[model samples]
Target: MKDFELDGWDDEEASTDAATSLTRTAARVEEERQALTEQALAERITAAVNAARPGVDKIPDPVDPAGTGNLTADEQERLDACVAGIELLSTATWVAGKSLDTVATGRLFRKLVHKLEPERCYTTIEEWAEIEHGISRSRCSQLRDGWQIGEVLNARGYKAPEGQVRELVPFFNRHGLKAAVGVYEMVVQAIGADKVTAKRLRETVKLFPGDLALSDEDDVNVIAQSLAGAIEGATPPAPKPSTALPTELKREVDRRSVALADRLDRGRIPRNEVLTHLLAAFADERDSRVFDVVFERMKTSNS
Candidate 1:
């Protein structure tokens, strides 16, 4: 009987040890599986972020705070241009409470950076021309796709991502899109101090919504002047004679009366002259005739 009891106890001990070993093995396998899953997820996220190739996410520190600057020669030139633009358009009010030069440099730097890093950026020049500048939509579309034009546009701002510049320029050039770079300077210089001209330009030629959203009349004027300066070399439309002069041609009419209020800060323009040129380009004979009546009245008031 003692022998039988010893054998039975050994069998029971064997069964308990086997069950414990199985549980331990199962726990180890689960841990390995979980580690593999975590590693895979981490790798995918890293790959996605790496693909984005972003620049600095935060606003950069200003180069100066007192409006007096310690910028490099090129940077100083850019600042001077920005300053000239602000002063010329009577937009000095917007230059208040901040370092205009520093702000200008920072913005310019960002533009350069964005142009250099085209993978994550977009160009608005073509869109600006199409929506606001009276450049036909088809022309704008062609410009975007035309290789040389695109090159000129980009080169106006920056060199392409490494050697990519060479290819882009050729493509843009071949497609009849060769652009003279740095036209932004011209834009600021044109239409200086003609505030009313600025507002009309914004209404008629503003291609980008973001640019047009500026509420300050002076600021809008300054920007309009800048754009006009860029394209001052462009062809001006011819004036056409109108047949039927309406009663609104007299001084008392209300429509386009606000046109007379356009100021030097608005983008210093020869208001009637520009209106006439633009009307000739944009309006039908009948519409231009209607414009003549209001224009005659505005001329009388300013006279």
Candidate 2:
């Protein structure tokens, strides 16, 4: 009986050891599977990130086509450095126009011009630019003006295209940077930044005029808000085949016509003062004709 019990006990112990070994093998397999999954996930993420990145076109070396090999070593080195500097300035100019970093580009232009002294190779900065880049001095001046305007706007956490900002330089000079910035903010708030084109800004400046008390911040805000309200509430004028009466003038004419009809019903003609004001309001020749046509029809019908 003792020998039989010993054999049974050995068999049970062997069964337990086999089960434990199987569990260890299963755990190892699961761990390997998890590691493979994580590695695949990482690779997919890397590929997605790379795919989303913007592609940069390689800039060709500007000095490559110059045939500088025939020149002396020192001359070639100087030319290479000058060309590189000019290339940097050109790149910065483009980036500044796009990114609204005009101030930095303007400063870099002056610094590069002084450092490279294009006069050594060409007669003037303008000459070098015209010959190599086809950029005019007037354009350069406009960029510089854009930079000045950018300085004011950037300080207030605002941005505009170089062309749009250039339109405001005169306003800045007349009303000061603070007033200009106020106007810019107001216009942007009213029409949106994208709609603040050079033409639009120029019109706003003309409408507001330089003689107004734009220096006062409160007054500026009030004017800006008034303009903003007008912009927001005004209806887009319908397309007209011929030169149509201005919308505001049309509204005025309608209101006055009703009032004039009431006065005539009471057997009274419009006062001389009233007629004078009406004539004054119809400033445009085409608008005056429209007014004349409407009143003539009114007279013919009433008589």
How many backbone clashes are present in model 1? 28
Clashes of 2: 0
Top model by lDDT, which number?
A: 2
Q: Which candidate ranks first by TM-score, i.e. highest? A: 2
TM-score of each: 0.22, 0.35
Q: Write candidate 1's Cα lDDT for 5-111 as tens digits.
A: 45355777898999999999999999999999999999999988875433333223345543465767766675665554433322212122123234333443333
Q: How many steric clashes between backbone atoms does each model show?
A: 28, 0
For model 2, how does the per-residue alpha-carbon lDDT over 163-281 read when each residue is reduced to its tens digit?
A: 66767778777767666666788888878876777788887766663235543456556656755555555565556587567889767766776688797685434445565766676
Model 1 RMSD in Å is 21.6
lDDT, candidates in the order shown: 0.42, 0.62
For residue 24, model 2's alpha carbon misses the true position, in angstroms, by 43
